[model samples]
Target: MGSGRRNLKNAAVALLSPIPSIIFYLSLLNHCQRISSTASDGDHSLSLSPLWAWCYYHPLLLANVLFFVNVNVLFWVISHIQSSHWMIDLYWTVIPVMLVHYYATHPLAQYNWWRSKIAISLTWVWGVRLSHNYFRREKWQWGAREDWRFTDMRLQYGKHWWWVSFFAVYVSQQVFLIGVCLPLYVIHSVDEPLNIWDFVAIIACLCGIVVAFSADTQLHDFVSRNQKLKELGKPFVANLDEGLWRYSRHPNYFGEQLWWWGLVIFAWNLGQGWTFIGSFINTMCLAYVTKLVEEWMLKQDYRAEAYRLYQKTTSVWIPWFKSSIGGKDKKA
Candidate 1:
């Protein structure tokens, strides 16, 4: 049937989309090997290929180049083919882990071995936790849904969505993803020994993970209870204000920021304080995203009043005491 053929076509597209990026990576590796051999011969001439030279001497630049080819190009192609940009969300959980390993394993990478191990381990923990939450929220379905914001943008862009997504979804991600992972690069690029700041970073990172995990778990349960209420034809709960939700309108966002900023501590400890730029930009972007999310909530007829009250009382990002101005609503 046509449906079967269409499914097959999509599967093929998904499988083949990364071929170009894979080929590019292999070629780059081959070039790097050649350069290593040439350098081992003590030939100090400037006859090296410019691209290979840059990749060899500048790992971060090489990462950006690979990110452009893999995420911006290949991810966009697959998103276009699938008519959904959900893959980016899935990869978001994985890419930081990839970047950390990439920087740690790069031929020119220089860092304390134990520090690199700690960074890699923490990143994997974060990635695995996020990926698990993502899959659970999606009912373990792949590419079945995207972030609601993208859906809204798709409607806003109309026929132009195809191209607009290339920038909005893929291009913007390059900035955010690479920016946020700058700490990993910093950790690998420096040869700093263990210090007290490492302990601080470890505590901060672990706390962030714990907070995010707890908040997400509470949210999941709230959503699940709401779904059951709907299934049983009972009235739905308009807003969640219990647990971490009571203190912060977006504890998960706060926790995510904490995680990144925690990593920034590592970079800062390594004397690369400028690496905070990535986490700062990410926090700014999340602020805008929070605004959009609140606007969306306000637009919903059932939850509008409840969420409005919640917003007035709850801190926006940081978890804190509720405001006294908006008396706790009995309905929420």
Candidate 2:
């Protein structure tokens, strides 16, 4: 009887491994957003109910339910999970980051820069569309089941031990999101701009947003077409080899990395000095998160011999480059 049940520890490890940091960070942001709403209620006094109750009740129960439900809803409408791309989350975080970064660089509180307006505008446009698209893709309902990872966790944690698992998932993610958002506070407080670097930063931020949008749209088209091909038994092919995929194995990822760093660059250019360092940290975190995702997915395809060949011939994290042996790179 015991042998028939999967180990809770093993399930937790599997559920929590690979991209825990990323999900935690996302949940953290969601929690912070909730906290911010509370602050807007004009209650300066600290509240213990939700924070205390929910903080310890994360990751295991709350986080998975929220995240999994979110994903399923997105996939249901968009035909794919929209925000499943970790890049989308990373890039979305930039909206707050830009506000914080801009405010930090400009402390005089008089400069009215149009770039901030544009950045913030594009940020929301991209974010809302992406979020809505994701919501449409997933199939979510009351009493709905969970993804395999969470199911695995339930087996190991024991049927009676669900609350603990829920706490782990929820609380951990809440903390992670809040930490990453610290940069927003710094960026939002600024009100001055100096040096030519500020303009350059603005250009970079705008360009990054545009590139990211293009990359995501292109990928969406590619994936949709590929699915049709699969239905027709046309053999799995890297359709990305035609458009933006020709230049980079992950153009969307590249654009997303740029989107975050672009905001960071803008903040530094505004003369916040050390605050600009957050860009590097943010970039590293995103890279690590995406790397984990790649590893997880790559290992799942047991019959992916052709996919393996593509991975070998193409760049994994970076843009593919033309080797002396001849293959497409970012410049293709």
Candidate 3:
């Protein structure tokens, strides 16, 4: 029965992978047609520049298409990988995709020009690279399930709810993507030249990139080391004491917060005035996600008790202090 269920799941992934692209493309084309028709009805109908029209209307569509395509590919590839439960694996990417959809449909998209452009660009880059990297790292196996989180979710959601769960997963990702990238819309709206605020935003973005890349690199290295150890018949143990992990229980999470908030800062620099709402939302959501993950990690491993210590000492969302001089941030 388990084997049969796995086969069904793989088949479902195969079928659904291609559907998102078609839907994305169709939606984009439809939106374009609407915009063109609307423009043609105005007095300056003939004056509407084709280039301008595309520049203004195409970024969101392009971003959506890129995100959908990458995620679908990820689904096809990961579904075949015999590792990790599928549902939890789906959560990471799914949340972001939902944010994408939300931003695409949000009022900010209509008002924040530069914000939209930056958001679209960042989404395209992050989604494509991450998806490709993920697909390349994992191999396929027939009748294999996905990430353990997915399995847990499947059990929790019940056996008869896969269809609903599937759509929810997809839609959730769209909304996440939209929400996280909201600052881009605000950033794009700026009509002024770069200023001090832009410099501040640039610094924040650079810091985010460095810290995020460093944390991920460290985590990957740790995982690789563990795999090597396993190959030598060593038991798997939680290794969170060294490097950035020592500083914060979740340095990668911290970096992620910085990256998104940095994007929000960019929107602030662009100063679309009311577009600040997008930045505010992004920051708030980042805090919430970080908090949730921290709590979950704390629960997942009580033996180490390192997470609780790290939480107490280090700043939750910001990488502000050193662990050595001050000791674990007693008031993290």
Winner by TM-score: 1
Error of 1 at 323 (Å): 1.9
Candidate 1 lDDT, 1-332, residue by residue in tens:
77667555655655565566557656766776676677755642244577666666777888888889888988888777677888788889978987898788776779999989999999999999899899889876566577999999999999999999999999999999999999999999999789999989999999899889989999999999999999999998999999999999999999888899999999999999999999999999999999999999999999999898788788898998888664543324
Give, for candidate 2, the lowest lDDT window spanning 10 residues.
Answer: 79-88
Model 1's number of clashes is: 0
TM-score of 1: 0.90
lDDT of each: 0.86, 0.47, 0.54
Model 3: how large is the Cα RMSD against the reference? 7.8
- lDDT per residue as tens, model 2, 134-204: 33332211112244344445577775534544344433333344333333343444555455765665666
Distance from true position, residue 245, model 1, in Å? 1.0
Which has the higher TM-score value, candidate number 1 or candidate number 2?
1
Each candidate's TM vs. the true structure? 0.90, 0.54, 0.59
Report the Cα lDDT for residue 318, model 2.
Answer: 53
In angstroms, give how far residue 282 of model 1 lies from its true place.
0.7
Candidate 2's TM-score: 0.54
| Ranking of models by TM-score | 1, 3, 2
